[model samples]
Target: MDILADIATTVLSQLQKPTLAFLLGGMMLAALGSKLEVPTPVYKFVVLLLLLKVGLGAGISIREADLVSLAVPAAAAALTGIAIVLLGSRSLARLRGVSPMDGMATVGLFGAVSASTLAAAMAMLDADGIAYEGFIGALYPFMDIAALVTAILMAKMAQARSRNVIPQNGAATMALGGTGSADNDGPSENRTLVRGILTDTLQSGAISALLLGIAIGVLGRPEAVYASFYEPLFRGLLSILMLVMGMEAWSRLSELRKVAHAYVLYGLSAPLVHGAIGFGLGMIAHQLTGFSAGGIVLLAVMAASSSDISGPPTMRGALPEANPSAYVGASTGLGTPVAILSIPLWIWLADLFIGL
Candidate 1:
């Protein structure tokens, strides 16, 4: 508990600020169209470690050295987590009457991931010598794509609602999706949606590294465990990822002043709700899917991670209505990890109660 508390304070207070600054700077440059960019290799490296850490951590925990035994649990867990995210988000959005964008933001968040948090958890799990599997991390990219697509659709819905209204400061130009100006003005957006997804799948570029990692794993190549080269590579990547992620966090916090209450509420509630839902979902999936307890636990963990990318940034970035960064920082930095750590203990208590 103390360790978790320390992580929460350190991550939210220290790390997040830096993450924000860097990302905001990068985004502004991208949006305003500054040529300055994080190096391609650097971006890829961070994302790679992000995937590796999660995969290795889970792989180390599963200890399926033969690679064959890993299949059942990984499959069961991934399917369960994805299903919960997809179905749960759509349901929640409709119920809340949140605009399509909000629903997408909410639901999309359920799929996007936090590479940093996953990396940290993986490292801890690795050090503890717990055997996990690659499949868990492999699923991350798909999760990302799902979230992004959903967000786009949601954004489109929100846009449709906006109709003919003139957005402040040529808002149409800044939006994504190769979208034309809302008032039919300015240069059109590059049709990156399908192209982006395809490029990611085929080229293994910055936005699609997770998919690359997944493909590598799916093809039965978890051999990185025995290889020594990946560790140094990961260390180099983590430093950059952490530094940039920290900068992004800093920038994100500045946005919080606009919607402090909603941010705090999301921060507080999301982790607990998501965690419980994940745990329950994992259990149910286990029974239905015939996966092991460890496998089920992993599924639950994935579900808890539903908010990884979308949930946090939504709170932190553009929309003041829901501060995703705070939600993520507070939850992932603190809530999810604590939840993961508590899971075994919780199960033990549950078993004890049942026995009594």
Candidate 2:
């Protein structure tokens, strides 16, 4: 009963946050048919700023962090990303109306990190006066890349097996769909596929901005500018981002309905389950490295969030045959909202177990 009461209180507190309030308000406006929208260019620009802010902060923190402290958590994050996709391939992909490739793509998005969501979690923790490792943000790319590579590889292997492509000279030369190369044998084909996925992920707009910011923060002294510009504007810009996301979530609902009921269920539940898995691994990392409760919460947030920006384009290019409505709809329409809302739950759990 005490635990239940704590959860209730945490949720109530979460609902009152301006960040979430803006999100809910946007959803309300969308539901009322207000036809309001943040312009696409503005949204993209806002995302860039947010990513830069997060990356800078993380890079600064990473500069002072001990390599040993970072190792355990980073490894855990990468493992979590791989595990989420593999688990989904077995369970969610096998459900009625969900093809294996489509299922892998959907889970890939879920497994990848959401920059906006990470920013929100950081904001929320700051508001609550929780102290987390600043370097926690550095874990983003590890998890993001791992999930994407694993998903695409698994999806392609499944595709190959399903088609029963015969091996020639002990190696199937059939190129995986998006590689733009057909001359490679089975092993070489896989190497090419992985190399392409890594290149695409690294070169992606979101990741690129983040990596640039991190490099700037690490290699230069931008603390003055960071403190003067990015820090002051973070919350206000985030509110706007949340508002845009809420409206976008509503617009995607119709697309969600076009997919199987299984997708809807997966979207709604995957965040919690995935988050718990992250939280559990975080616990182990905490014990091993004295990782803060707040860092644990952020790690869980990364696991909970579905990729809104990078994962979709990557999936579209890599798994072109997969239906967009299934992966995109399930993620944007349902998974994102649930993940956002689950922040408070994770925070409460982290504090309860680890003493924030």
lDDT, candidate 2, 207-263, per-residue tens: 999888888888888899999999999999999999998998898989977888999
Quick one: how many clashes does candidate 2 have? 0
Name the best candidate (by lDDT): 2
CA error at residue 80 for candidate 1, angstroms: 6.2
Candidate 1 structure quality by residue, lDDT tens digits, 169-280: 3434334423544554422332443354334333433234545444454455566652665665664565466445434443444544543344334444554455555556
Q: What TM-score, computed on C-alpha atoms, does each candidate reach?
A: 0.54, 0.97
Local error of candidate 2 at 233, Å? Answer: 0.4
Per-model root-mean-square deviation over C-alphas: 10.5, 1.9
Clashing pairs in 2: none
